[model samples]
Target: MPAKPRILFCHCNYARVVPDEVKSSVLEGLCKSGQAFDAVADLCEMAARRDPALKRLAAGESPVKIAACYPRAVKWLFGGCQAPLNAEHTEVVNMRELNAEDATNTVLNKTLTPNLPADGSVAKVEGEKKI
Candidate 1:
């Protein structure tokens, strides 16, 4: 690979729900859209996987760039990355918040924001970090 871009997905709670078919479709669309890398799924999976590669990227790369579908995803990878990565590169797509599901409209609206502590700690509901 020719210097692959470092893509991270922060606080992607819907990872389990994001159907593989949708993922493939989005990736195909992205490939057609432009020259953007097809590392979206990998990045998201890595974040979910809590891979050390994220920290390595922050340590080695300059102008460490990331294109996330969610800003919380950035925050998720931020502390673990071991460097002060820019917040700008992170993008937050309000799927649960903005997409506005009609079925759970009442419940979702009340719980839109990311589940975070006041001290900025990710309230670990699931998944364990691999040592």
Candidate 2:
């Protein structure tokens, strides 16, 4: 059997980007399911601090599922910290867009779907501008 993708949960503690109920629900589900997972208070803070955990998480060959705000944002955040995730082996469940149940279900699901957008997902291009 293929190895199960590692689960990474972002609490988004500093910013209120992710709804309180959604984060709470997803966390509850994860705890109830008894599946081992890594939870961080905030991804943005981790990136700002250049946390080594990000590198550790991105170092392995196994796929990873990250429950966070936006796929694009998460992608860039990881890249900014020099721990860029594999675009083909990472999945970000957008808690901002997905309800608690949907986010929780997707994270728990065994199917691995690489949802991280391609390069420039964060407007890194020379001409790209944030509107």
Could you say which candidate leads in TM-score? 2
Clashes by residue pair, model 2: none
Point out the worst 10-residue segment of candidate 1 by lDDT. 103-112
| TM per prediction | 0.41, 0.88
Off by over 4 Å in 2: 120-131
Error of 1 at 11 (Å): 14
Candidate 2 structure quality by residue, lDDT tens digits, 1-131: 86799999999998787899999999999999989999999998887777778889777899899999888889888887678898878989999999888988999998889988866533243353322
How accurate locally, in lDDT, is each candidate? 0.39, 0.86
Model 2 residue 23 CA deviation (Å) reads 0.4
- What local lDDT does model 2 show for residue 5? 90
Per-residue lDDT of model 1, residues 37-71, tens digit only: 32434455665566667655445442233323444
